[model samples]
Target: MPDLLVKLSWSLLCLAHLVPAAALLQPSLLVPLYDVDPASGAGLLLRHRAALFLAVALVCAYAALAPDGRRAAGLVVSVSVVGFLVLYVGAGAPAGALRTVALTDALLLPPLTVAVWSAWRA
Candidate 1:
């Protein structure tokens, strides 16, 4: 039962990441990799910010309350690191910008995930 819940929570977190990365970041960041117009990219970023934030919030809540939070959190943190690397290298963005984003994700996600998992197990 706990395992299922943990897996579900992890899945949700993964989903949340994908939603924003695809809808928000790609249009703004990835498009620019291909030399798309900055204006259009900004438009996507603006349009999806709220939805993206909402998704992030939902996943955060799930991660906090689910069992196996430690493992889930670790996986999510790994996902973010992998995501940033993919975006940074695969997209051909500047190293500093990618590193900044990657580091931000690393700092924000792991601790929270662990906290939530601990709460759930306790």
Candidate 2:
């Protein structure tokens, strides 16, 4: 049951990263999902952000498959998400879709932390 929970947590992390990755990779595709202007400089920035998300997703997926590295992987994922949340909130409460994303990240922290703790104990 613990193993299943760990896998589920990691899977969720991968999915969390994947969403932004897909949106950033193709901003136009997210036009309906987010309020981003694909033609603007922000759109270009999102593309760059996509690369980062892809990296995180890869790490998460790898961790889920490789039990040995689950602890470190969970830590990395937790820290990254927490850091992003801090920055997002410090930036003065984002509006619209960004706010939703930030909230999602905030909510992910607890589960990610638990996953890391469990993996460490195991």
Candidate 3:
């Protein structure tokens, strides 16, 4: 049988990433998502970020079902989440939606760890 925890974790990651990825097609989402105007440079960069997030989501969806791909998928997801949290904290941890973003990533850490551990044991 497939590992349930891996499936759940990767699936969650896929969905989480897809939310931001949608901003690629719908730039207006940036306003509600991060309060940035779509015409601004930050908005342009955030749109690019959305595309990158789509790539991660694709990888996660694939890995959720493919055992051989789990390690790489987990690494990619972990690095993305952890790197964002670290950078955000280092930047003095500003308030607002970004802090919510960081906290969301922080909350995912435990489940991610459990998934990786279960896979390793298997």
Candidate 4:
């Protein structure tokens, strides 16, 4: 039950990081997600990618192994999920309707949210 949800969330988070790492190695792999906009330079995108990987690893590991860590990670996951949803809707499909928000941003919603709710109810 709870253990299953936590493990699934952690595994999905790891998968998210690994996918981007593969893309970071190749120039062609990045072009689709990061277009050459004036505000978005290559260096910034690289830095952002690295930061996301770090976050995913740190949070996922903590949530998976530590009881207290799950509470904190659950909080972050809840807030981030809701925030992405709001940002996507407010921006009026800025990144191609629901493409970005619908894909990667959706991974944390159900299991994380349920785990957090269960924790609170416990």
Candidate 5:
């Protein structure tokens, strides 16, 4: 059961990242994804951000499938999501499409805590 929780959480992390990663190929996705204009100067940087998210997703998927990889993967995945939420709230939790992203992160917290505890138990 503990192993299951760990794997499930990692898989969820991958799914969360994959959405943003899709913007690497489809820059127009930025509008719905983050309300940024793809034609703006920020396009390049945002695409790069997509790539990074893809890398995270790959690592998370691997961790879900490979027991030996979970610890390191957990560190990477947790820091990414938790770090974003911290920065978001610290930034005053400004309202916008990004707020939805923040909400998503908040929703993931419970499962993330469960996974962490389960991992510790195992």
Candidate 6:
């Protein structure tokens, strides 16, 4: 069960990274998901942020496969998740499309945290 949880958690984290990476790589693809105006400035920002997300995703993929740095990777991911949540909430409640994103992040937090914990314990 512990192993399963760890794997599941790792997979979820990978997905978390992949989704944004895709959006960043092709902002047009995520038009419905984010429901934002496809302005040049916004697109540029998304692409810039996507680079960071890609880095995180690559690190997480490596951590999932390699035992040596799993803890560090988990820490990085956990911190980033928390930071995003904080910023999101602190900025005031999201509305419309972003509200959906906030909800998804809220739902993902528990499992992701648990996965990191279980992986560390194992």
Best by the lDDT measure: 3
Weakest 10 consecutive residues of candidate 4 by summed lDDT: 31-40
Which wins on TM-score, candidate 2 or candidate 3?
3
Q: Which residue runs does candidate 3 get wrong by more than 4 Å?
A: 119-122
**lDDT tens digits by residue: candidate 5, 1-122:** 66777788878888998999999999999999899888887877888999999998998899788867767777777887899999999999999988998998888787667655565556
Ranking by lDDT: 3, 5, 2, 6, 4, 1
Query: How far in Å is the alpha carbon of 76 misplaced in model 2?
Result: 2.9
* lDDT of each residue in 78-109, candidate 6, tens digit only: 77677777888998977877677677677778
Query: What TM-score fits each model?
Result: 0.40, 0.84, 0.91, 0.67, 0.89, 0.82
lDDT of 2 at 13: 90
lDDT (CA) for every model shown? 0.51, 0.79, 0.85, 0.60, 0.83, 0.73
> After best superposition, candidate 3 residue 7: deviation in angstroms?
0.7
- Name the 10 consecutive residues with the lowest summed lDDT in model 2: 25-34
TM-score of 6: 0.82
Q: lDDT at 33 for candidate 1? A: 34
lDDT of candidate 3 vs native?
0.85
lDDT (10s digit) by residue, model 1, range 1-122: 35555555455555545544553444554443333343675555544653554455455556545544455555544555456657776777666444565555555454445444544456
**Model 1 misplacement above 4 A:** 1-41, 68-81, 92-98, 108-122
Which of candidates 4 and 5 reaches a greater lDDT? 5
Which one wins by TM-score: 4 or 6? 6
- RMSD per candidate (Å) reads 8.3, 2.1, 1.8, 3.6, 1.6, 2.1
Comparison by lDDT, 5 against 6, better one: 5
**Residue-level error in angstroms, candidate 4, position 68:** 1.7
Q: Is candidate 1 or candidate 4 better by TM-score?
A: 4
Q: The CA-based lDDT of model 6 is what?
A: 0.73
Looking at model 3, the pairs that clash are none
